[model samples]
Target: MHAIRIEEHGGPEVMRWTELPDPVPGPGEALVRLGAAGVNYLDVGARAQGTGGWAAPAVLGAEGMGHVTALGPGVHGLAVGDRVAWFYHPGSYAELLAVPADSLVKVPDGVPDELAGGVLMQGLTANHLGTETYPVGPGDTAVVHAAAGGVGLLLTQLVKARGGNVIGLVSRPEKTDAARAAGADHVLVHSGAGFEEAVRELTGGRGADVVYDGGGADTFTSSQLALRPHGVHAYYGPFMGVPTLRPTDLPNSILLTYPVVHHHVATREALVRRSGEVFDLLLDGRLTLRVTGRYRLAEAARAHADLESRRTTGKLMLLP
Candidate 1:
């Protein structure tokens, strides 16, 4: 099997496309022939600084869509030739993956493999963020930082579909258009001076009922200010480096919460249930998975480069 492996952590250059031994499914696991794999910023972070959970020479990818080719002992409810997608910690950036049977979710008949691969991780994150973490409601106002990025765009659309107004913050004008296309009611460039003021002005003096802070260090403080009195601030990612916050940094009238999807949806059953709900929304056309870039599995290095350079938008997929 061919997989992208990082023998040592450093930069995109460290990601090597090399031949690796095929993974053998263990009991309660299934061997999946991967169709597409999603490349996330977490992959970048893992490759740059060895993922704390794993040793070096590790295969790096968190989620993907594939077909089950073989089932290990005790595996049931899935069979050979079953079309499925899964979320796992590592080993997805390969032609074949050995994933736990419990991790596999049957892909609906109409959802293409590409879309399935692109949306699994980001879509689920967006679902938990909008519906569980902050619970956006009709007439609610929210701010999404890096709103043109992968999970950000999907989250903006999901929030708006539920009738919430979204104020998006991006680093470029092109991203502003991208966010608007994804249902953002207002878009602000985060680069120039007065970006926070722009957010304040857009909300007409009063700020948003919630602020989704994905761009960590660069936009955390501004995101805090963008929230309305007693508003919920959900800080989900650290694409810009994790920001530090003190008790005094938060508004007296607001509440701050940092929710990780894995922690929120703790058990396998919970993950499957919440993922199914989001999948239904996707099938109904209420949610859109915008795949902004696609790369061959062998071009994993280039993909990481593009993501780090901020040359792409929305989801980035690796076709196997």
Candidate 2:
């Protein structure tokens, strides 16, 4: 088997793709022959400085989709040859992965391997943010930062599906059409002058009902300012840098939360339920899974570099 291992915490060069012994299933785990793996900001953060309780000299990645090749002892829900997708477990950037059986979700026949891998973590993230975190509804206004991003595009669509008006924020002008196509009511340049004021003006000085800020350092303050009184602010990702929030940072006593997806879907039942809804939306054409980039397993470093550059839109995948 082949895998990309992080030799040390640093830049993209730190990842070394090399051969390795094939992994075997352990108790309550299953061996998966990976078809595709999801490339995420979390992976880049792990490559720079390890997280999710991992150290150097480790295979890096958390989500992937493939076929079950072997079953471990005490695992009964799944069998060999089943198509599956999973997230949160590490070491997914390889030809084979030994992941817990409970973490595996059966992929529908209509969903391809690449789309399955690309959507699990990111889809569930947007699911929780749009449905559970703020529960967007008719007549509500939403401001989503990184609007052309992987989760951003999906969240924009979900928000619109629920009849909420979307004010999408992107770093570049080229991304406006994509955001608008995703059902965003309005698309605005995030780095441009007076973006928060623009949001206020769009809402007639009332501000947005909900603000989803994934680009932390660049958009955090503006995200807060764009929210209406008693509105909710959901901060999930901090690509630029983490922001500091004080009580005075928000006007009108707006709500602030840093909701983690893992915590939202902590139970296996919750995971299945939320993931099933996301897949249903895709299968029914209510949600479109945009896999904007692809790379070979050997090009893991290049994939990470592209993701961190923030030039790419939608999900990026690695074919193993």
Q: What is the per-residue lDDT of model 1 for residues 1-320, given as tens digits with 9 covering 90 to 100? A: 99998899888898888898888999999999999999998888888886546567798888899999999999989989998987554878999988988888899888989988878788888888898888889999888878899988999999999999988888887788889999998888775224667777888888888888887666677777777788888887664567777787788478988877787567878878877877898899988888878899999999999998875788889997
| lDDT tens readout by residue for model 2, 129-168 | 9887999999999998888988898999888888899999
- Candidate lDDT scores, in order, read 0.84, 0.88
lDDT of 2 at 85: 94
Off by over 4 Å in 1: 192-194
Window of ten residues with lowest summed lDDT in model 2: 187-196
Name the best candidate (by lDDT).
2
Residue pairs clashing in model 2 are none
